[model samples]
Target chain A: MARWEPDAQARLQNAALELVARQGFERTTAAEIAEAVGLNRRTFFRHFPDKRDVFFAGQDQIEADLVAGVTGAPPGESPMGLVGLALARAADTFAHLPREQARARQAIIDAEPALLERERQKFAVLARSVGDAMRERGVADLEATLAAESGVLVFKTAFTQWLADGESRSLPLIIAETMAALRALYVTR
Target chain B: MARWEPDAQARLQNAALELVARQGFERTTAAEIAEAVGLNRRTFFRHFPDKRDVFFAGQDQIEADLVAGVTGAPPGESPMGLVGLALARAADTFAHLPREQARARQAIIDAEPALLERERQKFAVLARSVGDAMRERGVADLEATLAAESGVLVFKTAFTQWLADGESRSLPLIIAETMAALRALYVTR
Candidate 1:
């Protein structure tokens, strides 16, 4: 029961995640989230437009990191390698989340249809951003788009495994293994 | 303008798609959709909860076909082969629409955020269904899910290409080429 003022947004999101886990998304509301975090209704609105916004606040940072990672890869790296680096960067971003927190968030997302759809749009936005970033770096056409999309797909699989395995292993290792698996899936053909 | 009713559900969906294409989804109303199809608004509501449901009417059928194809693949067919067959069935379903109608439908979906999210959910559902079907047929854990997801990914690539190309070439051939490319992407590793 520590009173923290500057971390309101984070506190709100945490509260929302907790309620979503305990009572399910449909039963949770903005007022409940605000009360859970010891904040009033107006303060919650100032931080997030709605309850869904609380779940999505981190997406912008993730997208920015991905773009930065791809753009800042070693000069000689291929498109695939650059994309792989971006995935590694994302793994790093999620490394600090406690395993229970990660699982709770994921379970909430998995159970809610609208949230799942919003999650997909976020991924699609990231993929398109990656594609655009690739094009800026001289990769062209559908090839760039597909490479970016493929990287996101691999990252998703890797993250799923990493989270499900109790977060004992690092995300980068899981991403590497996922990339290797993708290579094998196609290479065997 | 021919008027023939097969099922109330089909008529409502067709009306919705047609109206959305002509007037845009943002402007179309359920009442107008009912008027266009010679059905009462109540009948339309009975079949679909909202306007978005019309474009997705065929989705359940597509997923059913995917499940059937994945589960019914012959004993010797590999996971990739089973994926290929399931996608071919999807292409067959898409092929039934007139090119203009297909393009019109896609255009509407591409322009709407809600519709775009719904479209992603549909693909996710199909992927999950395909994975379940594959699992039922003895495919293992992560591998089955990956194969199912990869199949949807390639199918999406092929469909985007086909729509952009105005559906001149064979859908199956385009899908096969995309699948081959995806396979090569990993195989080269």
Candidate 2:
């Protein structure tokens, strides 16, 4: 019942992640990835402009879900509270991925400087999306931006913790802990 | 006595900023920057790797100062306090530059995507430097990194506010305010 061919894209992405994890993003070529998936290079390019593209393809969907989550928070929550809710939702979305798969993905990204830069850019884009969503609900500009950036910070902190060794904690719990840490900074000030 | 040949590097950097501000980072060439500095292109290349290098010449010095500040904080001060002190000091170091020159430098960077990427890389380097300094001080790794990253966030937020229209506040005050906001995030949680 899906509108698009989800399995095909998933296969290509998983193959790219696997090859990149083994050989490194810089060393892994699109041709090898396509061949691994039993698809031609042209079909690979149809799904992604490059290997980096595969890493970023999920971002649009993530942003849409984030916006919806922020906008639909319970009736009386503060702006910051709404942002917290959105981040919790995002953490939950990623929670079902196997730990080994997530670790491999993070390792692939950490090994590539270009991929890290692109990740930063993607975070910036997500921040702007959060800002736009907050503004739509009548929050002003600078505060919206500040809240969005703060949300991304919290999300990054939790994600990093979740990806680390001995981290049996859930992403949502880590996110709540990070929010507490950020709040502690305010209190100490 | 000053340690190095100051005028040559300063003149070259100023010329590059001026040209990039008047024209654009992409449109301005190394030859043009050299000519503006009253030097030949070869002399320009002697001091900087390329045109982009001119914008980031003193980051090493700033990072050194930040590490020193972090390592020397009094016992019992949170890592965040030490980092805030370093950021405030760095902002003050730039305070002597004419406001127009500061704006011009930022304007050139704002106009170039490549320059912005370089700036982000520089910040990441600075963050790692601070984190490493904290690690050397016996702070645990993840906490050290979080504190270091939080410092960079405060610096960035303060810098953006300092550059905003009608913002007559001092850099330290702005940084302190940002720290306060960051702390508030944790408190209200």
TM-score of chain A of 2: 0.91
Maximum-DockQ candidate:
1
> What digit string (tens of lDDT, one per residue) describes model 2 on residues A52-113?
88777777766876787788887766668878878877877776768777788788888888
Against the true structure, what is each candidate's TM-score?
Answer: 0.88, 0.88
| Separate DockQ for every predicted complex | 0.48, 0.40
TM-score of chain B of each: 0.88, 0.90
Instruction: Specify the CAPRI tier of model 2.
Output: acceptable
Evaluated at residue A135, the lDDT of candidate 2 is 85
lDDT of each: 0.80, 0.78
Please write out the lDDT profile of model 1 over residues A1-189, one tens digit for every residue.
555579999989899998888898989889889998788888899988776788888888778878888998978667777778788787788767577777778888889987887789889999999989988888765667777888888877877887784457777787887777766655555
Taking all chains together, the TM-score of candidate 1 against the true structure is 0.88
CA shift of A44, model 1, Å: 2.6
lDDT at residue A83 of model 2 (Cα atoms):
85
